[model samples]
Target: MDLSCFKAYDLRGRVPDQLNPVLAEKIGRAYVEITGAKKVIVGYDIRLSSPDIAEALSSGLMAAGADVFDIGLCGTEQVYFATSHYKMDGGIMVTASHNPKDHNGMKMVGPESRPISSDNGLNEIRDRVLEPFGDAPQQGRYEPLEVMSAYVDHLLGYIDAGSLSPLTIVCNAGNGGAGLVIDELEQHLPFEFVKVHHQPDGHFPNGVPNPILPENRAATADAVIAEGAAMGIAWDGDYDRCFFFDENGRFIEGYYIVGLLADQFLRKTGGGKVIHDPRLTWNTMDLVKAAGGEAIESKTGHAFIKQRMRDEDAVYGGEMSAHHYFRDFAYCDSGMIPWLLVAERLCQSGQTLSSLIDARIEAYPASGEINRTIDDPPKVIAAIEAKYSVGAKSVSHVDGVSIEFDDWRFNLRMSNTEPVVRLNVESRADIPLMEEKTEELLAEMQRLNEER
Candidate 1:
């Protein structure tokens, strides 16, 4: 087994070279051993190699004396739903999730759809896979189940069907697993869906399913304007993260969406705790506080966020990367629920998406996360800290280095999954100052790179 395939949160690597059937089988056996799970659920995405990997994983699980339920052709979140909904012991979703075409991986969860990160049980499974183990004396059973209708029902439970307006929504699935769920949910709703790249194409003819990149965003934005739709939504490859665009076809930043969703959740629950990542803070803090809720900051990453939400008894949690977690939804992030809640907000408020977010965006102009590749990430980070920490209002290292001043602030952190440093800058309703400070930080990073 190639150890590099195991990541901080999940398993992801190039096909055959790093991840394949044999290693997947080993992972399956190791997971059963570590969790001591008697029953497990397995699922796959639209990737070309997903079915084979899922089959291998199921075989290994069955060989380990664990009953396996195969839920075919589903998104990552669907596995989460099935694991918790069916009261299964554990689950795994075969997906690369917004990675390039030639890559594949797995997202694992324990009972109740709780995450299995490196800190909890991922590293143990990784180590066990490297050792030798024989099959059990007797094999377990395998069963097939259909979860689409039930999954759609669970999704619709988040919002009232009668309250939704008859608005046209542009849905760009990016040829991933999201189209199937969207189509299923459309039958139960009153809204008109203008589908784009709706088919599940493993080859990704349109492009990779990641809408966070500017190159992949144009199709969704263009479709929204051309269709004269109320709003546009796009999802990643496995559809665990969803992005939104306004009626004017402008791509709304996920930072403001976090605030918006936090506010909505607070309103629904009256008063509760909301968890947010440390990258961008002011907007979420302001919104949560104003809504009579407590705001908690956790380190970035899904594992950390979910754990913090559980610990704090938070009603909702959100990351600037468009991952939203809910207490009602097993404390797991859902790509499907955020848009539905947003749609409900629009319908009940009788306001366009732009109008709803305009004030928040204006009040806190931000530079959506900028990434830079440097030879020495630590040195550059240290340099940034040393330079900016003098006479600063405060400095914190919860996830990375975040420095604050009176009106402007920025957070610089190394990427957990990629080899780049992410920088995010924001100011109090000052776009010019945000741009200037962003450029200044970039120049400093460049200088440090040159010195290296």
Candidate 2:
């Protein structure tokens, strides 16, 4: 039995060979046995193999004496929402979440939608899959649960709907599941949605919905320009993370969005803690401070951010990777809430999206996360840290080494699942300085790599 599909955070692998209905059923039973979850929320994405896999998984849950509340064909966050909102014991979302169309996986959460990563119960569940299993004495029941109406209302609650005036907004679903959500929210909002690639198709005609890549962004950017939309939004296959494009068709880096959202959320709450990743900081720190909100830095990754959000009782948390967590939403990340809040801000302030972001870009110029394939990441990173930390004002390793000077800073961190190192450099209102440092750092990393 190949259990390679089980990952550090979730399950992700090619279908049938690595993950199939049989293993899914076993995983479901294992999940029930491990967590003792009597009631479970089961949901799946728009992948071709999702329905069959979800069905098998539900069977396993029932066999293990867990009643399955099937939320059928929704985003990963929906599972998170259902599990926490309805007080379910746990939830499982069958999705690879922007992985290749041929691949499939699952994202699991325990009570209160707290992530069940390797540090928690995911690894134990994986190990238990190999053990034998028999049906419980009393079989559990299955019910088709419809929570979309309530879910949509919950999403709308995050913003002032009356303040949201008419604006042309471009939404490119990329043939993923976000369109279903946009359609549901459309009736209640005042924005004119210019829908592009708006449909649920597991075939992924416009390629996988990951807008993180430069190549994957043109469709949304072009649509924004062609339609003269106020702003454009794009989501991954599962719609858990959303990317933004300004009114001028320029893709806004997720770092800036973090700052913008922090400011917006702080205004509503009066003052609260905002959890942010360490990779990029100056901009978010500035915004949070101005908003009268306490800025707290957490190590990058959903599990870390979510846990910290829970610990600090933070009102909101964001990663430069585009995951935004909300306290009201059980500390889970939501792709939909961020956009709505941004739109409401635009409506109230009567400011264009590009104009709002341009000021921040000028205030803090950053080298958007640059990745380099280093033969030895640790050695390269350590050498870089040693050389740079000499005259630096401060050096912190909350996630990876982040060295800061009086007016400039840079974070050097290695990818969790790859042999590549990601570098981000920023300067206080100086693009040339930021660019020069970025080049200097990359060249130094190359030199360090070659020395060994």
Candidate 3:
């Protein structure tokens, strides 16, 4: 197996060349051996190669003396749900998420849907896969498990269906795996949905299914305005992350959604702990604190966030990248729950999505996240840290280098999945200051890149 296929958090690489059925089977056997999980759940997305990879993985698991429950043709979160919902020993989803069509991978979880990251156990699995190992003493069993009905019921349990209004919602699945869940959930709710790119096409006829990129967002936004919908939502290929847009067809930054969802969850539970990534902080911190909830700062990435949420027993955790984690969901990130909770909030509060987030947007004006490709990310980061640390009121390395002064702050970090450096800047209700600082940082990064 190519070591590059193993990422910091999950397995993702170009298909066939780096990740395929042969390697996937090896990974499956290695996972069972490393974790000693007896009963495992397996699922796949709409990717053309997913079914084959999932089948190979299950075969390997069964060969390793583990009972395999196949939950065929589902999203990544469904595997997470089934793992904990059925009390399975472990689970694996054969998905490449929003990666390009030529790429594929897997997301693995241990008991209770807890993530299997490099820091936890992925490295051990990697090493074991590379070494030689014989088959188990006895072959295990394989069975099919239907989890759609139960999954839908659990999603509706997050919000009162009676509280939702007869509002029109625009849902763009990006021709990924999200359409299946959306179609199922629509039957249990009263919202009028305008579906765009709704079919599950492994070819991704619409695009790569990543709504974070500006090029991939127009469909959802246009549909929201064209259909006069209350709000618009879009998800990645595997449907583990969802993005939101307002009724006016304006794409809302995921940072404000974090604050909105944090406030709602805090209010719903009467007060609890909330976890947020360091990339964007002020708004989440302020909203969480105001709701009488303890706000905890965690490193970015789903694995780190989920572990921190479990450690803090946090009611909710959100990353500006559109991943939302719930304590009740076994500390796993769910793309479905965030929209449901937000829709319920809009209904109960009798406010448009715009109004609900406008105040927070003004209060903590921010530059949503800016990514810059540089020759040497470390050198640029060091330069930024050295240039700003002197006058900064405080500095933190929880995930990246975050420096703050009285009125403004920014977090600069290199991307784990890409060669770009990401910068997020925010200020106390000053849009101009935020913009100025963002430009200043970009200029410095560009200068460093030229020097390199």
Candidate 4:
């Protein structure tokens, strides 16, 4: 068995080559050994390879003397919800998220929906896969279950529209698993919305259905504008993250959405605490602090943010990547929550999405996260630190490397799963300085790449 399936956040790779039935079986045995659990709930997305991978994973789990409750055809979060909702001993979701259709991945959740990344038990699983393990455990069995409806119901529990007013929204499912959730939710929720490419086409005919790309957003934005919808919401393959389009079909950056969600949660929870990734906004921190809540900044990535939330007991957490976590939802990010909150806010205020975000952009202008190809990310980071460390109020190596000045700051870091350096620069109304500093950083990264 090969170990290439092990990735930064989850077990992911191209199907049948890097990730095959044999490797998945070994992973199941290893996961059971690591967790010492007897019962596991398994789920999968609507990918062409998902069902086969799900079967292989179940075989491994059952081989390890674990009873596998196979919850067919679901998203990663549904598995998370199942782990706690049904009191399952553990769970696994087979998905590659927004990756190409050829790619597939697995995300695991321990009891109570605790995530297990490579740092936790994925490495051990990888090791076991490399060296095929001991005899299969005894009494392993398989059971089938359907939890999609239950999962949708659980999501709706957080958003009740009894006294809510309605408006038009354009929902773009991107031909991913989100279509199922949106389809069900629309049946119960009274809202006039246009849906584009809501079918679950495993091939992802329209270019992987990822909302992050301008090309992928075109259909959704066009639908929103053509239908005269209030706003547009587009989700990634698994619906783990969501992006928005304003009434004018302009794509609203995720950073502002994070701040908006933070504001909403802070208002409701009376401002306990909110956490955000450093990649995008200090405006989130400002909003959290302004709401009389404490703001905690953590590194990018869902695992890092979730861990920080657990440590801080934060009421909410968000990232510029569009992942929004909630305290009520076990501190895990949900693509579903943001839309509900947005709808509720719109109903309550009778304001459009653009109107709500106008003041936020003015207050905390951002450069948006920029990525550059680099050979030696560490060397580039060192060079940037050496050049800009002067008069730096403070420095943190938390995620990548972040340096702060009195009025502005920047975070330059390498991608954990790729060969590139990510740069995010923000300032106190100094767009020119931000651009200049960004240029300096990009030049350094290019210089380092050439040197390498």
TM-score of each: 0.98, 0.99, 0.97, 0.95
Q: Residue-wise lDDT of candidate 3 within 1-452, one digit each (tens)?
A: 58678987889988898988888888889999999999999999888888888999998898889999999999999999999999999999999898899888999999999999998899998888898768899988999999999999999888978788888999999999888998898888989889999999998888799998999989999999899899999999989999999999899999999999999999989999999999989999998999999999998988889989989999999999998999999999899999999999989999999998899888999998998888888888998899999978999999769999999999999998788899999999999999999999899889888993
lDDT of 4 by residue, 111-203 (tens): 877888878877777776666567563768888888878877877776557746768989988888887888788887778868788888898
lDDT of 1 at 300: 96
- Candidate 2 runs further than 4 Å off: none
> lDDT: which is higher, 2 or 4?
2
- After superposition, which runs of candidate 3 have C-alpha atoms over 4 Å from their true positions? none
lDDT of each: 0.93, 0.95, 0.92, 0.84
- Winner by TM-score between candidate 4 and candidate 1: 1
Question: Better model by lDDT, 1 or 3?
Answer: 1
Q: Which stretches of candidate 1 lie over 4 Å from their true place?
A: none
Please list the residue runs of candidate 4 whose C-alpha ends up more than 4 Å from where it truly belongs after superposition: 132-137
Least accurate 10 contiguous residues by lDDT in model 1: 156-165
Count of clashes in candidate 2: 0
Query: Candidate 3 lDDT (Cα, whole model)?
Result: 0.92
- Residue 84, model 2, lDDT: 94
